[model samples]
Structure formats: C-alpha cells, structure tokens
Target: MTNLTQARLFRHENLPFLLAALLLALLAGCAGGPAPAPQATPSAEEAQQTEALEKMVRQGRHLDAALAYSRLANRAAPPLREMYSLRAAELLKDGNYIPQSFQLLSEIQGANLGPEFHIRRVLLTADIALARQRPDEALAVLDSITSQLADDERDFRRRYHQLRAQAFEQLGQPLESAREHVLLEPLLDDPAAVQANQFAIVDELQQLTPQVLDGLAADEFGGWLALAAIGKGVDDSLPADELIARWRAQYPQHPASEATIARLLAARPQALRTPRRIALILPLGPRNRYAKAAEAVRNGFFAAYYARPRQAMADAVPGDGGAPHLEDAGSNAPPLQLRIYEEGRGAEAFDAVYQQAVADGADLVVGPLGKDAVSRLASRESLPVPVLALNYGEMNGAPPRNLFQLGLSPEQEAREVAQRAWLDGHRRTAVITPSTPWGDRVAKAFNERWLALGGHVVEVQHYDPKKNDYSLPIRRLLNVDESQARRKSVRRIIGEKIEFIPRRRQDIDAIFMVAFSRQARVIRPQLRFHHAPKVPVYTTSHAFSGTVDPQMDRDMDGVMFADMPWTLAPDALGQRLKGDIARAWPGAARRYTRLHALGVDAYRVIGQLNELRRDRAAHFAGETGELSLDADNRLQRRLLWARFQRGVPQLDTTEN
Candidate 1:
C-alpha cells in the first residue's frame, strides 16, 4: 500500500513533463523522416517512351511519332499533356497532315500552357495557315505574338523568322522575305542550315531588278546585294570566274560559302559566238505552197534585223548561184552578210537548200519551217554548220547535235495549260479535244503532264471539231447523259415525270478543252447549258486568235489559256513593231500576227542560242514567250496566262 501510494504521487507530478517530452518526440520524428517520397513523377517507363518517341522524330518517322505523342498526352497531366499535344501537332503539320493537325491543335487550349508551349501553339497555327495558302492570316497571327518572344530564345526565334519569311514569299513580297532569311541565318548553328539560309537570301534578292536593287541599302545584308548584282551584271562577254574573283577580293568576309559561289558560277551564261553571216532558208518562192506564210516570216525577220543598228543593210546584191546577199553598212559591229535561200517542201529538197546555204559560207543557218524538213536536218549524224531549225523534230531518242529547234509548238502550250490548272489547285479534270491530229497531240501532252503532277483525268471525250454542235461530248464529259438517263429510269419506275435539272459529275474540278476559238466559243456555252458553267476551262493559245475581237469571242468567256506576250501585253519594242506593221502591212498584221511574232523571235533567238545553250536557266525575252533551252536543245517557252472576260482576253497578273 505504501509503494502504490508513492507511485501514484510520482505519476501525478510527472504527467505534464512526460506529455511534453512525448509531443516533442513526435514533432522531431515528423520533421526528420525522409520527405514524403516526392509525389509520383513521370515514371522511368514514361521517360523511356518519350526518348523513343523523340528518336522516331529524329529518324523522320513524323506521323508515327506524332501518334505516339498523342497517346502519351492522353495519359499525361497538365503542362506535360499540353507539351506533348503541341509536339504532336507540330509533327503532323510538318508531315503535311494539315486538317488533322489543325483539329488536334483546336482541342488544346494554349492559355493553360506555359510561355514556351503557348508560343509553340501560336507558331503551329500560323504554319497551318501558311500551308493552306492563307499568308495574310499567318502573318497576322505571328505579328500579334512577335513581341512576346524573348530575344535569347534562339530556336523559337529561328522558327519564327522562317515562318515570317515563307509568309512573305507567298504574299509576293520578295524583299521582305529575304530580310527575314537574312535575320534567320545568324541564329542557325549548323553549317548546312546556315548555307541554306544564305542561298534563300540570295534567291530573294535575285528577284529584285537592278533599279529596285539600287533603292536597297547595300551594306545591310552582309554582301548578298553585291552577289546578286554580280549575277545580274553577267553578260555574254565577261567571264564568270573573273567576276567571282573580283567579288571575293571585294567582300572577303562575306557569309556565302564556297559551295554557293560554285553553284552560281556553274549556272553562269558562257561567252557567245556571234555569227558574221546568217543564212535563212524557207519556202518563199512564188510556186511554193508556204510562200505566203514564208513571206510573212521573212518580213518579221527583216524587221528584227533592221531594228539592230549593227546590221544596217547597204544594198542587196546577187550572189554567185544563190539568193541575194545583203551586206552590212558601216557600223560599230563587224559587217554581217545575210542570205536568203528558197526551200522546197520535202526533206531531200531541204537537204539541197541546206547544202547550198552551207557552201555559200553561211556561219549559221536558221530555217526550214516544215516539221519534216526539221526532222531531216535533225536526223543527220553530224552537221557541217550549226542549224537552229524553225520546227521541232519528232525524235524518238536524244536530240541531235548542232541542231536547235524553236517553234510555236501546241505541245508546249498544252503542257503549260496543265501546269497552270495544277497550280490553280485543280486535281480532277475532264478533257474534251477535237478529233484531229493536233487535238490528239495537245490532249496527250496535257494528260502526260497532268498525270505526272498526281492529277486525275476523270473522262476524256473527243468531239467533231468541224461540226458546230458539241452536245454529245459535252454531255458525256459532265456525265449529264448519265444523270438524264437516271431521271428517265426513275420516271418510268414511278409512272410519272417530275421537273428536273441535269446534274454534272461533282468530282471534276476543271475542264481541259483542246479547241480553237470557233470550237471553244460553241463548246463553252454548251458546257454552261449542260450545267457546268463554273468549272474552270483551261486551254492552249489556240483558243484566242492573236487579234482582239470581243464581239466574236464573248461566248468564250471565263476560258483561261497560255499565249505569247506579243499577243497579250507586248512591250515597247513590240508596240513599235505593231504600229509599223499596221501602217506598212496592215492585212498581214491582222491575219498573221502570231506567225509574224514567231519570225521575229526566230531572228532574235539566233543571237541568243549560245547563251541559252550554255546555261539551262538563261532566258531570252522573245516575242514568243520567256524562252529557255531544254536538255534536248528544243527551245521551251513559259507563256503568259490570259482569261477571257466578256469576250476580251485580259492578261493574268498571277502567272508567277
């Protein structure tokens, strides 16, 4: 009893102290224990998955990587989820899955993300707008957020500059585009990337003319201006290597790599050999079938020849057993001798005339207009002298040596029409061609080029070009016959007739009609009557006669075709020639305008052939078109586009 009483007193006295010591022990334990194992972070497995997905992106398996990132985003939390979503959208856009990427991008709210991710979202949106060819929208979106980006964010800044540059390029602002590339170059670390950016800068600068270039600050672009000026100043005489050496000495610290300089040097036009004597052979004799056409060509040739002061004719004198030789008068350039030889129709006749021209000391022979004659000259294993044939040869293999062909081939125009329609965003097309050889050639060329561009020819219908009526072909092309037949079947099934309008096939986005104006005028209206008025009609130059007769061409409205600048918007030289011809040869000016242009171009090309031959990129601004020489030595043309509105052809300013 005494021990129990003592223990009770001890317990009562120590109760408060024991309680305090226990509470202090509990607090110390709580503070010292390993901090609550940091709330579940991205697991090792998730990190590994991220690395693998990034690896896919590096390997260029963008779609696969994008889909994987989406899966990860679905399972991840805030910030991380937003980041993965942004990444997925980027890859999809890069891979050209625009609609799907935009849809995914719409699902992610950028406001909730961090500064970096929000910027990424904005860039992706702008990029998609650019892909859809809406540069204005892209530029607006970028301009709004440009101030928010920090200067030190090199990667984001680089992308921002690139998108801005591309937007400017699409909007036809080359100078602005080049400025962005110039800014982007310094931010790029990789050597190849830097080189590419430099080239892009030069390319944009090249689009500017010398007059335009003069207005720009030379020092601002780090020698890009000097480089482009050197490119533009290149002539037929100055050696490109020498120019390059001078450029190097002038700007030793320029950023353009040696590779870029080398490429420019390779593309430079080589020195040309101006012929002292030129012989023109054509069927110009009175009895020749092409005499009238040949005379028109001869007039055009002389017009171009006399236009140059270096070749002023003294007087015509009869040569020894050949055509008359016209000697050049006193001029700065060396005296030139021009001789005209009358050609016969057949290849053998062309051979005789060609032999005579070459024997007559002709340094260059330009002529023999018939296709067969050109083919004959082209078939020869070797020619004694260079000949720029006026017609293209039907060669089964590589083009012959020393023979350059330049002609207003319908095939070239057909290919250009296909290109124009393709660029206009047309994919599916129906072709209606005249049942003729020329029509077949044009249609074949269009089909070959259109298909090569990954376009589809839904249906091709050949119509009788001679007949004025194009109902059958038009109906077949639009599938109106099928629609009408279905209506009839439905009426029979219901034992009654109902009011109906024939419906054309909804799949075709365009129509490629190979017809002359007479045929096209009738066909276009029939197309409208067949319920396909809005479908864009694309054609070759044949659809528009060289003269403007809006009253007659009114029915040919809304038709787009590719034609020569001489017929569309001739420059000062062309206008002068037109005026002169109108006063001198009014009838020929109206009747054979295109043929006259052809002759003028033929004469102009003789001096330019060497430049075109040496450099594939060199162009001659001829009356025919923007002329360039193909690998086959065939002169190809980039024609201007024109659309008929209320019967008159208006030049399309959007050809570029």
Candidate 2:
C-alpha cells in the first residue's frame, strides 16, 4: 500500500484500534530497521537459454545439449564451469565423439577444480584413449594418478583400476590385467560377480609360467599372483580352514582373504576324488625298451600325488621337487592301496596280468603304459573294474565298458592343426607329409577334420623324411613346378621368351605338413625356397622338438603347430614339473616330455575320468591338455597352438 493510503487509514475515526495499530506500524517503519532485499529472479534471456538447454537434454538431443553446455561453460560459476565441461564430455563420449570428448577433457584445468573433477577428467581422458584403441596411451594417462585415494573417493579409485585393467588387457599384459582384477574383486558388489571376476583372474594368471610370474612376484605384484594361485589350485582336497589360515598368515593383509578365501569356503565344492584301491601297471621291467619312459611317468604321477598347497607355495616354484614334495596330509585319503604289476613278455600275457591285478583287489587300474598292452586289454569283452589305459590303441570292436584310454596322440595334434587353420580362415590346404603309415594316419586325421569344417584339400604330396632335398615334394605341393612346366611349354610352342614369374597354387590358403625335427629343419626352408613362404603352414607337434635347439630349429620359424599342454604348459605347476623333469632326466626329456605329461594325466584322470564321462561337455584341465571323454571311451586331448618365432615355440594368444 502507498504511504498516502496508510496516512488516510490512520486519520479515520471509526475502527480506532485498527487505525491506531496502522499508525504505530507506519511510525515503526519510519523508525527504520534493516531493509528487506528483493528475491533474485531469472532475466528473460538467461531463462530462455536455461529452458532451451533443458529441452534439448529432455528430448534426447545430446549433441545439441552438449553444444549448449560448451557455449555456457565460461558463463557458469567456478565449479559449475568444470561440471559443464565434464557433462559435455560425457555427452560427446556417448555419441561416440571420442576426439571431441578428449579435447574438451584435455582443456579442463584439474588444478583449479575439485578432486572429483580432476579424477573425472583423468578417467574420461583414459576412456577416450581406450575408445580410440590406444590402450598404451590410456595406461599412460591413468598412471599419472596414484593408487592411494581418499575414503570418499573409492568409486573413482575403482574406476581408475578398472580402466587400468582394460588398458592392460588390450595391451596383452594379461598378468597385469589379472592383478588389477584381484584388486577389483573387493570393489564388486554381487557375490557371483566377485567369484566370476576372481575366476577370470585365475584363468588369466594360470596362463603365465612360473618363470614369468617369479620375475614379477617381487614387491606388491606377488600378492595378486599368490591370490590367483590359490583360486586355481585349491580344491576340496585341501583343508579349507588350514589352507586359508596358511594364506592369511603369509598374506595377512591381502584383500584376497575376503575376496577369495571366505567365498571359497562357503562354496564347498566336493574334494577331488581319491580312489580307495589303485594299481599302477607299468613297464618297469629292466630290459623293457619303454622303462625310462615309464620312469618319467612314474615321477610325474608321484610328483602330483604327493603335492600340497603349502609345499607348492613354499617352494621357489610349485611341483619342482623330485617326489614327496609335501608332508602327507593323511586326510587326502589313505595312501591309495598301491600295487605295481609289470607287463610280461608278450601281448598274450596282458590280459592275464590285468586279471591278476584285479584279483589282488585293484579298483582303479592306471595303466599298461605301452600301446601294445593297451591294445591287448581293449580286446577283452569287459574289465573287472575301471581301467584307465595309458595309451589309446587300435581295437576291432566297440570299446569295452569300464575301460578308458588316455594317450599322447600325434593324430589329435594333426587334427587340431587343421581345425585351427580353418578357424583362422584358411579355406583350402595343401598337404606334404612323410611317405609312411604314421604320416598317413596324421594326414587322414587332418583331412577329415578340415573337410568336416568346410575346408578343401587342394592336393597331397609325399616326401622322404630321411632325405635332405625336399624341393620336389615342396614344388608339387605348391604347384610351382607345374606352373613352370606350363610356362616352358607355352614358350617352346610360340618360340617366344617373355619375363614370367611362376605362381604357386592360389586355391590353397594353408599347408598341412607332418615333420619331425630332422625333416622340419629341411622341409620348412625348402617350402620357403619353393616360393611358399607366405602361405601359412600348419603342422603336428612333431615339427617342434620338445627341447629347443635354436640352430637346428631356426629353419622352422614361421611354421604353426598344435602341441600339448605338456609341451607348452600355461601354468606354474606345469612349468615347474617340466623344470623338475629336466633336472632329473635331462636326456629323457629331449623325447619323453610328452610321456611325462601322460604320466601326470594318467594319475590325475584316475580321479576325474568318471566326472568327465558323466558329463561329455566337461573337460579336466590336465598337464597333457584339456582332457574330455569321447563316446568311444577315449579321453581326447584338445591341444595348444603355437607358432615358431625366432626359433622358439611361442604359445598362440588365440589358443585356450
């Protein structure tokens, strides 16, 4: 109301109390206290701009909203200005404008912003690098931040670690990636997700060698390696309380106690089955040709059978001991009622020996370690008990019940080579193998699997493995000589000579070859000599000598082969066993590494074969390979792939 109106009300005679109160309020106002300020209101242009930005965001026009935020960023107040840039970056990133987001984030001054904004900018920058497929760049950006974060900042810390892991994985630094995963498990909320991420860490570390892990397990790096080991190797066979207690003692401060050990105890999967009565049928006779081979196997079986989680942890490397590496747990199951039987002079005596072993109360018979003896056993109608024969054999009729075969089969490797080549997009293949029954077997296996996978066999050529000159076979395989023949014929007929380069067969995208070291040294280079160097060559494990012979193997470079886990072990235990075997019988390992793997698996499978057979899809991760049960009672090994690089067989990253 106006002052004149108030004055008029005060002058009124009626309603004297109201008029007196109004006069007193007017006098009080004139006596003046602090003046009341007006409420701030949006100006027309500012209001319109704010509404437009909100409208763009609400309507899903992210680019327009991002542009508006960018335009308004300078006009925004201090912290709000950073928020505007960050929001714009987020919008740009979602729209796959990585470079734009990166540029915007790069321009942000973290020193002038809150710690949260600084973290966001760094994370956004790393994410942008990742989006551009520049993991190393992303890692470099992330590395500028330290591991130490404030209590309120753990979310950003976790994001930093997650992005670090992604960058490491993209850079093919799996062990580092796995370490980050170990750290990340605690940050994860879902129990299942935690377990899955823990398993992923285990799976990744399980692919590294002890030699490699040992190099890294210095300082803080050791904690994650130790955690992953426990996840992979600890099972029901271990005393849950004791195992975790021991781990806690060594790594009392590690987060794995909560992330891994506690969860494992709760899961309570059944312990690895330990057979009550076991018989080891070996070729241990003094004069037997396979005696040393059997010895390698025996050592391997004993090494695994006697191993302990603590002992493996205590040793420089797991499974590096000769035998009895750990004090007997005593609860792992009574030392298997052990019996040893030797195969006699003839195949005719095999059945008798097996029967006698069964009569002696053997329940799980491990082997007749030789192929002939296995073939003899396969001839029987049925076995008295479950028998896991060491070598797969040729049998006439259907495989007998309660009999399972586990062999280090070259044929399996050959088939895997074909499958791998096909998987790598090899449409047609040329075959050049030895002119022998063994070569025929392997070639047939490769061809069958390749054709089944819709790959074509362009041609086949045989070579003399003993011969040094492989030019003829290589030329035939590549059809280079045929091209030369056609060129010469054309030149003679027309009486004209023009520059011409002979072209190898274009239909074949890969070569399936079978060669031992002796042949490989010549065949590989000879194929290259025949102008087929660029055509990928896939071969059985025979192409690689079990032991590295750099000078001799140099020629085999660029050839891809399928080998067993025995030869290309992906785990520390396997690597350590290999080291132990080499130390004990260096000479035998030059040829018997595969047999050692067989021995290890033979003992392992006795406990797991039933599980595998029950579930056809199940695989036992064994030293030999991933062992799976086939319908024919054979435990087939799915081999590892490698390419000869710089005279070394490097495991293919694509291999499982």
Candidate 3:
C-alpha cells in the first residue's frame, strides 16, 4: 500500500478497527452476503472451509490458511470477490503465498472498488514482484497507481526511486542508478533514512562495473559521489579526499554534510608544532655536595644543545643564545623559608620556584635536588607545568599530574644484574647477600629476575657484614655435591654390602654477591677456598658506589657488576664530567662518578621533557647509556657492566 495507508493501518488507535475490517472482509465471502430473511443456511463444504481457514489463521498457520482462502475465492460470487481479494491481501501480509496472492488480486476486474482496495491491490502486487526480483513488474504495478497515489505519499516516491535504482543497478546501469540516488537524496534528511540508503547504494555499487565510476567526472558532487563510488570499489588507489571534496562542494547545504566532512578530515594524521619552555630549578650554593654536580649538569645540558655545529646549535637553542633560565634553590635559610613557607608548612620550597617558572611561561619544570624537597614537591597538587622531580629514590607520596620521578633504585640494579647474568649463560647461579634489609631487597630483585629468565638459583645464603667470618656461607653456596652425604648415610646402613660411588661436584656457573666493599673484600678469597675461583661474580650498583678498594681490586678482579656509565667514563659526556671533577678536586677519586652521571642524565633528557611526559616508551641516550621511563615514570637505566681487572675497574665492552 502507499506509505500513508500502511501508516494508517498500523496506527496504535486504529489497529482494532483495521483488524475488525479484515475479519469482516473474510467472513463476508463465507456468509455469501447478508443472510436472506434469517432463514438461509450455509453448505457443509463452505462451513467446513471457513472453519478450517479461520482456525488455521488463528493458529498462525498462514500458508495453509492462504491455500484455503485461494480455493474458496475461486468459487466465490462477483459481489463476494472483494472479500476474496481482501483475504488474499491478508495472506500476503502474513508473508505466505506472496506471488499467488498477488496473482489472485490481479484477476479482479475494475468494478465497484474503493480507493483503499485499489491502493492495496497495486501496492501488494508491487511488493510481490519486488520480492521475486522482478523490479520491472513491480514498477509496472506502481505506475498503474500513480494517478491514485496522494501527493503526501513522499516516502512511497522515495522508495520507488530507491527500488528503481536497485533494479537499474541489477541491470548493470550504474549511472541511471546514481541518478535515481541523487533524486532520492532529497528524502534522506533523517539520519536513519540516510544511513539505510547510503548502505544500500554502497552495496549495489560494489557489484557494478568499475568503468561506470571511471566515466564520472573528477569534481562531481564536489567529490562525494566519486568518494562514495571509490569507497564501494575494491582498489585502494582511489583519491578519497578529492572525491569527497567534490561531493561536499556539490551538497554544501545538505544536513550533516559538514559533520561528515569534518569526521573524514579528522581521520587523517597531522603533525602539531607546539613550543615548550622548560624550567631548571637547582640549588647552586657554597659547600653543598650537589653544587658542583648541579653546575656539571648545567654544563652537560649546554654541551648537548651546542654539541653540533654552530648552525645546528643556533637552530636548536631559542633566540640564537644557548643559555637556559636557572633559578637557584638558595643556601641561606631565609630564601629557603620564603620558598617553602610562603605557601605553607607542608608545601615544598620548590613550589615558589615552580610558580615563578610558570609565571615566566615555562612548559616543563626539572629540579629541586634534595630528597626531602623533592618528596614534599611530589605531595602537592595543581602545578601549572609538568614537573620532572629528580630525587634519588622512590618518593614518599603521589606525584602531581605533570610530575614524574627519574631516580635509580637498588631493586632496578638487581633486576639488571639478574637479566645480564642470565643472558650471559649463567643458569646455575648462587646469591650470597648480607642479612640487612637492603641486602634482602637486592636478593629479592635478583630472585625475581633470575626466575623470570628461566635460571635456577642453586643457593641463597645470608652473611653478617660485621663478622670477619665468611667461609661457612661462601663454602655452602659454592659446594654442590649433596649426593656424597646421601652416600655416606647409605654406607652406614648397609655397611660392606654396598660400595657407594661419589657423584661429581656441580660448580655454580655464577655468584650474585650483595655486599659493601669491605665485606666483598673478605668474601672474595672464600670462593677460592671452595675451588670455584673462575666462577663469574655479579654485584649490584652499591658495589661501585665507593665500596671497591684499590688494594683488594686484584681479589675482586673478573667480578662484573651493573652501574651507571659515568662510573667508567664510557662516553664523551662521562669523560667531560670526570675531567671536571678531577680539575675541581685533584685528590678526589672517580668514586663520585655515580652522582655526576645522575646529574648529566637528568639534565640531558630535559630536552625531551615533553616526549618523556607524554610517552612512557620514549628512550634517551644518557651518561648511563640508554634509559627509559617505566610505568611509574621512574628512570630505568641501561647500566654498564664493569669488570675489576688487575688493580682497576675496567669497563666491559662486550656486555652492557
């Protein structure tokens, strides 16, 4: 039926009347007109047929009911033919005997028919032909109803064009189909209608020949027509945007046109150029341990910026000058008080410095060296810039939105040692650590890494650092023939009846020793007592932090450990820092290289502050080789492995 008639039939309040009309139409044919003076009786066959059809229909056996109705309509009279046609239409609505119902309706002569019946017959015939893929037949049926169709039946017109387009597409006439689509486009203002039609059109175009699309003009529909066609095509070489732009230009006033264009444009990637200003806040004061270290960091940053040729440096540094604005954290009590308490008690002294930096238009904030200050800074909130808090250990509280900590931990060192040793073929390993909590922490990290890398820990023994005795734990970890003791017990039970053969000793491939320089010195010789001198030993970074002595370097030789690259002066940055330290303090050994390397790396990566803040995977080359931020934004350093050879700690080139 026409859209209006279909809507009218399905209306909520009119549904009961429609059903009653349908029932009456069905009953009229069986009753054969109004009863003649109330004395007329129906034939048994007629009554049986009516009862069976009604019972089947009520029971939802629409196909069986349709056949009964068709047989009944064949014998019905002229006056009752309308009821036959109506019954057939109802059967068609039930989606049973679709073609046969239409065929039955088509047999009706133009007699005393109302507009509703005429519309119903024509629409139902068209629906059947369409369902059977006979679009030409459906169009012919629709053409017969054109004069009777109402002007308000716009949805029918749209569907007519849509179906015509589908027929044309099936006939391999894509251009005609496209023209019909353009004509129907006006009725697609509703989102649901547009989406449905768009999908239908796209699906049809996929089956059409590519030459149809190729024949279309480049700038057609400002390119939406071409894009839609291209989107339908299988080839990826189509110029998508050009087609879309043409289509959009043609239909600029169309609803959701701009939104579609914006969505399509947004899908393309574009690089954003955002300028960033970083603030370095450091304590530059007399007699402070970090004063020279801070200066060395500043020098390192300047060196990185100016490391290239003059033109490259000029391009990198802002405004042709390479100097960065630095705010000293101050040595005097008043300035420190002003920096901290100007806000509040718990507020950090660096807060004011940060505020000043923000006021000066900084995008990133870097320092405030001391642990207490960094920890206090971490606890506060709502900082204007992203802060890279540079404390040496894990901070006390939650960091701010843009704040990150970039410090090394003993756990991190232990994990690195375990990974390196496992990668270096150390499967059967032993761990000899001190009884302190720090030693336990190292042991835990080592155990985790060793287990993760599919290595077996032969033994884990703890030793007291204060005691001079290290022979017992060292000997137990190094000795591995427990079968001998088992054999001895068996011998005692069996006497001379069984002679037990001794099993060969299994030497531990490696030892992960956790101790200070003094304790390490005592334990080094004990490995020789167990006859496992050539067994490789790995230590944590604490071993390199002023713990190794020159006198005991021979005993500690061949012992490899993970440490910052600055400890061995691996690169130019490390070498420069070492030179500065030697020039500043001639008598001072390179023991302070760890602290120096921390400063250099912290400064060097400041250039990548934005990337570091945004991307957790961003890696940087530092005085400690390669470094990356972990999930918590803690700096995980790519440590260097140094071997103590002869009388000096030599950097291991092969493993890092």
Top-lDDT structure, candidate number: 1
lDDT of 3 at 564: 63
- Model 1 — which ten-residue stretch has the worst lDDT? 1-10
Q: Where is model 1 more than 4 Å wrong at Cα?
A: 1-272, 311-334
Best by TM-score: 1
Candidate 3 C-alpha lDDT tens digits along 217-271 = 4423324444454444333564666656655566655443655444434422221
Error of 2 at 472 (Å): 0.9
Residue-wise C-alpha lDDT for candidate 2, range 56-115, written one tens digit per residue: 666655545665666555455445555666777777665444444555665554476656
Q: Candidate 3, which ten residues in sequence have the lowest lDDT sum?
A: 332-341
Ranking by TM-score: 1, 2, 3
lDDT of 3 at 362: 62
* Candidate 2 Cα deviation (angstroms), residue 390: 0.8
Candidate 2 colliding pairs: none
